[model samples]
Target: MYFPFRQLLASSLALTALTIPARAQISIGEPIPFTDTFSGTLLDDTFLVLTAWRTDTGSVNGGLFGRTFVGLTNEPVGEATVSAQSSTTAPNFFMARNSASLSVENAEAARYTTQSSHGTHTQVEFFTPTSLTPARTRFHWNVSGLTSSTYPGVVTNADLRFAAGYFPTTSYYDFFDLATQENGGPLMSVSGTGAFSYNLPLLLNQPIDLFYHTVAYVGFTAEGGETFSGFSDFSNTHILDRIELFDSNDVLISEWGMREISSGQVMFDQNGRTAAANGGNNIPEPGTLGLLALGGAALLGRVCRRTKKGN
Candidate 1:
């Protein structure tokens, strides 16, 4: 009788460990509140605020970000890019958000595994037309869920990747640009998965806006330099409950939206399609944005012509 009771208790504990929520879904039009957990000088006043999480479900997890440059010029600035500066400039656009949680749970004293995942994401709201004096101006935006995140269980390291340009096949793909400092050096690269910051030399006198996204990847080997694999053996897993963004003073400025991601959701597919929409996501072009910009231009042109006739 004693042996049977012990076995039942052990089985119950094992089942509880195996069953966990991997993904969290929320309503699209809902209003999520942001609380200030940091107080200090910011990188910029404008921020791409967010929150993040981890779950017991998937192999590949991801978040989404969006922006609009409405009422700006239609001329392409080529690909949109981001620049990071210690100080803000006239017409300068910047994202002031930072990560909150950086460490995983202590497994030595605990029973389960631990891990972490993150990277910054920015989408161009708009670019200033070459025809415009400032070149690039104006921006509108939103961030992907969970700007920061972590998960641990047989996983040792995390990797962050950015998309300089991601679009739907229904339209031509336009490259969105981002600026970042890698290994303590400043350089810009086109936005896409692989490595490094992708936006620079593009932030002079431009009022820009940014959006960010983050994802957590779990590794199997306890050692570093592990290979990427699909979600076939996540029966034993760890969860990230909260994600935060910190400032220079080490304060939490923003927290990410956290949820367990369903498995096999590759952030960037072989053909450049994001797993978020399976291949249905779209990016807009300068010309398509021109129609909206043209409305204001038409009014200005008419005003200039009228003044000439009166003179």
Candidate 2:
């Protein structure tokens, strides 16, 4: 069953307010990199698993409205389940299981619209133990599995976004579109099973507090006949095999492979303070602002649609 939008929002806000600083897990001064291979039974303490959703229900002419945001650490909320699961394909890996089903019937109006989405985000927030700036940095991750399916009358798509940076507010917690190069690192998408990396922008002469954020999302939408139904299932998908961090000289600084996750040495903070301390103007690499601008445009489109419906 789905939680009420207002209730979900209230619960998320309360959780955000109660979150405390994460313990120090990684020290930048060391040359050795930290890594986890997921060989353990449980997910390491270095990562925070979060589940969220955005559901819109309304007539086609009236436009879909209502959005609920839920951010829970290491728990399932709505149709999304964030956990560490094992399977034949992937013996040990981080998985985000999600499914959604909805139907709309408007016999008199002869119009109907249905939209549902579920997302799971794994975030690792950390701060530099000492003042140390690198010439460049690289964030790498491996995806082991991904799957998506949708029933007739419905169109579905699965998207993945990876980002890193200092996000100090609760507003940016579960929303992937809000991740821009300024407050967070540039958003990068992964299509299928494989490895990916991002060349992070340089931050000079400041105490650094950062978060590596990755989310797997599946959405289903349908609009047509007076009576229609849609169902989607995305399970055992978006599995992470390993995540590694490298410094300017290409030296591995930290890694989480799931094996030694506890000893992986990557800090996991829920509430970060770097942005507030640095005046909230941490700039991104040149030429990457356009990516976020496009995201903003998409968001604006949704707002415009709602405005037209008098919502």
Candidate 3:
């Protein structure tokens, strides 16, 4: 019995040496998708979708501080497009001195239009395409166009944008504050900043055949930007760079965007190399795959040795 136990332990150690780990990339049939083949899917290589929507101290005339969405697609994401904009302002307490909200103007894939020119403003909607494959998706909010003279609350630029993840069943907060000219309601006062997020979840195919919703809270604040309300010399615009999506592993799965700040409305750019473009399928590096295979073989060898000893 002692001899058999000793032989089993030896086999176990040998098996451990032969075992190899699996890569993070999804199999062809898996439901999730990748936006970019981030760092070739190494265990430590994670991906993130980045977009900027406003600049605090930069010129606003060139870019509109635009807003747009990235439709979710389970299939290998093909042709993709990115769009952003900046808008003119109107004078009003609802538009300025709000400090909590930014000026609102422009609309796309939405029915609401801009009724105010200079006060607080915003665009709200889910980025998830009405028809697309469902997975746990995350939307990245990128913001710019702020400074200590313009935004004082933040110590770093990365803290400017707001990232909110929402499920499917989440309810929308009405903008009644701006509507009724009251600060206590939904729409708050206007600041020099813009806010955005995509918290809605798309449909997923699974055992329950039920929906998996990921609702999120989206928007941004002026922090402590210079007050332009009740004054004409004060003016500003929020410019967004792009909206990005990621998978459960925190890997940047795919994105639909562009780098040109002054470019026209968002359109498909073939130059992007996000994972969605690669169909979330990538070849595992030989070094790592080889290690995993070796580990598996070692495990099998150990089991075989133990069986032989028992016999």
Candidate 4:
């Protein structure tokens, strides 16, 4: 039977959709493992931190760290009180007030080899998803100053670890691992029906602010690399952001950087997405960041100049 051209097209289009892969609807739910932020308060063994997880095993640093307390550990025994340091109960807005770190001198023999080297995550905790069915969980984090991080030496196998506990014991989800020693780190991600994981790397030796606006849930993910960065340093600021793991301690390193134990959120898609977002997140341009890095040019002098339409 003959039918109208427009109707025939509509019928054909509807049939085509039947063959396409189906998409599932999802959304973010309340945090599962943590409700409030604190210096230490984690379920032992569930929250894991390594002084040098995979950066590079050495004679100086190595071993897994479990954070089941409320403050820094491995601190040297009693000694004369020097000056002092300052940390805040509330983190400065849009900045990483929470901090963590490890030292080679205080670390035990490498967890991997005889000469181990690495640092532990400050707030190590175990996490599992119970909100949505299953999909790649999105990660959103922020940093304030160079003091967010510190590294006086080098590391070899630093990586962003993405894992999963999975519902009904789903498949292994460790595909979101990558070597994070390159420029601006890695700005990428992955997703699928079963699970998802993504990471944003930090730029070395620079002060920068960052944010994540998208919702791509990573079922169960954790961020910590190298266990330790060898000669590394981390603190809330000059006074608080420190890891004194030595008997003869001296605050020789500090930078405006990021937290060793980053604050992350797991989000899901409300409208649902068939694929993942693959875009270059951020890599400061030489003209813009270069000037800021040196403090040679006024903040707006060069960037504000623009030609008005038609002279």
Candidate 4 lDDT by residue in tens digits, 111-227 = 211011111111211222222222122233222222221232222111112222221211111111222224333323211111223332222232222211111100101122322
Which of the predicted structures, 1 or 2, would earn the higher TM-score when compared with the native? 2
Error of 1 at 124 (Å): 2.3
| Per-model TM values vs. the true structure | 0.20, 0.39, 0.22, 0.21
List per-prediction Cα lDDT, in the order shown. 0.20, 0.28, 0.20, 0.18
Model 2 per-residue lDDT tens digits across residues 133-194:
33455554554433433344223233345554433332322334453454543656544456
Please provide the root mean square deviation of candidate 1 (C-alpha atoms, Å): 26.9
Tens digits of lDDT, candidate 3, 206-297: 11111111101111122122221111111232322244444555444443332111112222222333333222212211222323323222
Best by TM-score: 2
lDDT of 1 by residue, 1-311 (tens): 00000000011111111222223212221011100011111111112211111121111111112211111112221222111111100111222222121222221122111112222222222222233322211112222213221323322222222232222111100111223344433212221122222332224322221222222222222123222221111112111112222333443333221111233233222222233423332221111222232222121111100011110
lDDT winner between candidates 2 and 3? 2
Candidate 2 CA-lDDT value: 0.28
Which is the winner by TM-score between candidate 2 and candidate 4?
A: 2
Of the two candidates 1 and 3, the one with more favorable TM-score, higher being better, is 3
